[model samples]
Target: MTRSIDTLLVANRGEIACRVMRTAKSLGLTTVAVHSAVDANARHAREADIKINLGGAKPAESYLLADKIIAAAKAAGAQAIHPGYGFLSENASFAQAIADAGLIFLGPPASAIIAMGSKSAAKALMETAGVPLVPGYHGDNQDYETFREAAQRIGYPVLLKATAGGGGKGMKVVEKEADLKQALESAQREAQSSFGDPKMLVEKYVLKPRHVEIQIFADEHGNCIYLNERDCSIQRRHQKVVEEAPAPGLTLELRQAMGESAVRAAQAIGYVGAGTVEFLLDARGEFFFMEMNTRLQVEHPVTELITGQDLVAWQIRIARGEKLPLTQDQVPLNGHAIEVRLYAEDPDNDFLPATGTLDLYREASAGEGRRIDSGIEQGDSISPFYDPMISKLIAWGSNREEARQRLLAMLADTQIAGVRTNLAFLSRILAHPAFAKAELDTGFIERHTEQLFVKPSTQSAHFWKLAAAAWALSEPKTTRQDDPNSPWANNCGLRIAQPRRFLLHLACGEEQQKITLREADLAGVCLTNDRLILEQHGQRTSHSAIRQGNTLYLELDGQIHSISAVDSIALAEAAAHPQGGLTAPMNGSIVRVLVSPEQQVAEGDVLVVLEAMKMEHSIRAPHAGTVQAIFCSEGEMVSDGMVLVEITGDAA
Candidate 1:
């Protein structure tokens, strides 16, 4: 029953599509790429053997249209289709459609997809299969009143989740009865938009639980095996930021239990291809089934690194009806691996999604045990129409400590220009004490918000010196053979008795560093009595100077320092209104205005809800204050730090 698929049509876009195409090409398969109008120039499209235009910019008009994908497959003469991780990958109807069209679908059967597609149905099936599950209501009752009553019985602090979606969409954490109604409505709306299903389920919110998941694979022969586990507790707004294989604090007993559960769950549905079984593990070694992602996960790279296996290759072989190549005992995991998601976001501003052209893009070299999976290139524009993920940086080491150290080193050398990113924020988080010790949970980011987003203190002396140097360097030089009117000659009366003076102004974080420059040359520049040398090597320049006009650009230690010149009058005005605060983190639509003018609120109070990247984020009050003015209303679009609201404190 082994059928060979010589050609593959990749039914997706971005990094995952490019990733799968690499594996397909390695296997000597002719790859066909399908793309929307906006994605015609994308990486995957250029790398594929053949390309088909899906004909629209919006996802629904192109990528999400099943008929369009099916037609493109037929036109391209592709014998098989590989839905890479999203779009139609988990859609049972799409899978069935491919089969009906007489094309091979490289995934699980339609029956298995249906069995685990719905959250409610999946929970019921797991319960019957003797799998541990969180206490919640997954019944058919869809009435709001019934859900409210169930919430009351489940006690306060419950999680309302959309049963048909993943990726943290349609999820709400209701702390008390007062917020239940609003939470439910919001969750349903998000669910409908994200998964085309509004039906949701209520579950007891597990406090401080670590999010872990097991990767499992199965073939048509009814044999399934688990590829160990991954710890994904470090997150922001329920989305995983960092993930590692062979979970940091897992014991052998717990690992075995979770692995066994994952295998049984996959076997229960007769799953084929690759899938992930997520679990929520409490502090006391108790774990509950979260949900099954019936497609290749975003964090699969780390699993592959430690397992020394190519998961994409396995998926292809399994789809070809190949029997399991290794027994359960033959499968082994070695060393440790960690993966960090590099996203186009401003971590300082509530981790808001950002979009812009990639002016400078360079990934860390994959030397030794490093791996980088990137979708963008220099000059590529990061569009707002899709996810804002830039790339995934993965590193493998002999142990978790070594992996952590290597990843930190890799992040430090990583650089991206032209748009705000979370590079600095990620570095801060990785250096945190709690994270170092593996003391992580979903709320880890929220708890350390201040430390993570702290602005660097300005260095006045360094700024002054650098500015003076730049001003001196910009001064006109005189040539002995030049006339006074010559362009190379100094026009003003040159006095050999006194040194020339230039005022320098440098601004750093709301303060100005002013200095006077006298002379500057290849030897050094003088700021009053202090002198510093200048060095130029290759692309890097180093020098020190005084502050000048509102901008100063200097080079130091092989790095360029650009500081804007500050206006003294403007600085005074800004300092006078130091308490006029609280701004939006990024450009997004204001979905909900939680507070009104003249309302008294305490620090950390919910102020507004901003929606970006198909996710909702709550903007809170930074300090206790009386709302002085409201600048935005629900449904209004806003830019970063637009001052959505102004708060006045008693001290101010």
Candidate 2:
């Protein structure tokens, strides 16, 4: 079965695709890229040796179409196909199809994928294989009453998850019986939309547990070995936000126990190639299997950094009938590595995905300890059609503290503009004393919300002054050569025999402030290399600043603040429509509009649900009001800030 692969096709898009291709090319294999029409000019497509147009932007239309992907592989003369960890990555039928087409599938056998494909089925199999499992119901009975009864039996707090998917989609936590029905409905809807499967399972929600997962690899020779573990406890909404390798504070005995258990789970299903078995480790060192990801994980780079191995290269070799690269005893845990996902999301806005052009994408310099894995470049757009992850910043150091401090510095040096991101939120987490001390768990974000969710509005008066100066200095000015004393030449309110003064209105997020700038205050302000330098009060300071039209994106203390210079007329108009309606928080399609015009609703009632980046976000009623009108219909695409509903507030 040692078949040679001279060409490899990546049947995916974005960073994972690009990352896989980089390895394939390094191994002298011709790399092929399959892309949708929207990704025709994407970084992955442009970097591949051969590119195929898959013809649609949506996952269903392009990436998930197994037949189209197979055809693309055949047409591109590819000998093997690599499904890069997303759409179709864990699809058993897709894997079987690739094998039937006489091309190598760079993943586990289709049988292994099917065995672990369903959460309910996987738990049953794991139970038979002697693997530890959390107490929950993983049965075929998905009825509401069944789940309600299960919840009552398991406890008040339980987790409802889509049986067929991961990545936090179709997952909900029901704290009590009152919240179970609606939570189940929403979870089912999201499950059906995201995974094409509405099956669900209820599990006892473990409290204060750390999410530790073991990375394992196997080959055709029935050889399998675990590659240590990753601590992925820092999360929001059940999705991992930060990951580090060689989980802190794990004893050798526990590591061996978990690693051996993970290998057993994989071998039970005859797993091959790269895989990860996730577990929830309680404080007492007991771990239970959560699930298994049959494809390469998003946090695989952290493992690679610590192990000094190319997992993609190993996957290729494994498919060619190679043996495991390293035995469990030989797998070296070198230095420590930590990674943070840089998402195009507003951390202050419930981490809702944001979409826009990456107007000024500049990553920190990658050297010995700093690494940046990204598929986006400057001017690239983060569309609503896919995941809004801009990049991942990873740092490796001699120890855990060294890695943490290095990652903190990396977060500081990185910059992203045009779209809201979690950059500042990441920096705060790294700098937090608890995190530095390795106090990690799934509820870390919730526990430290007061400190992590610091508002940009806490900026000082001097910060606002600098912002105003940058805006004023960036103003477009024209001068007449014939008249050196033209008033227009000095646009900063230059006047005859008077102190130059101007009223500036700046808005950051929902907070707006008016700062009066006088000539004396701005006399020492100058712009250089996209930085604003201030020489005021006999002190000098500089800030990274840029003016894109009337919006000033200033970097103060490693956080990007988007300040819009609003005119009085615009401000008056905004105040005029204080209660006009609810606007879309981000660009997406209206999945459901629950309220009809003229219908009365209470405050906090769910009204409109929008689907963006393959996730659904609900827009609720802001106050008790009557729905005056709804401007959007189901399936209609909407932009951020576009008014979707108009309501007339009820008078007390």
Best by lDDT: 2
Q: Which ten residues in a row have the lowest lDDT in candidate 1?
A: 522-531
Q: Candidate 2: worst 10 consecutive residues by lDDT?
A: 486-495
lDDT of 1 at 131: 83
Clashes of 2: 0
Give per-residue CA lDDT, model 2, range 424-455, as digits (tens): 89999999999999999999999999999966
Off by over 4 Å in 2: 455-460, 473-519, 522-526, 534-541, 564-579
Q: How accurate is candidate 2 locally (lDDT)?
A: 0.89
Model 2 C-alpha RMSD vs. true structure (Å) is: 2.8
**Candidate 1, residue 517: CA error in Å?**
5.6
Q: What is each predicted model's overall lDDT from 0 to 1? A: 0.79, 0.89
TM-score of 2: 0.93
Off by over 4 Å in 1: 455-610, 617-652
C-alpha lDDT of residue 351 in model 1: 73
Each candidate structure's TM-score, on Cα atoms with residue i matched to residue i, is: 0.81, 0.93
RMSD of each: 6.2, 2.8
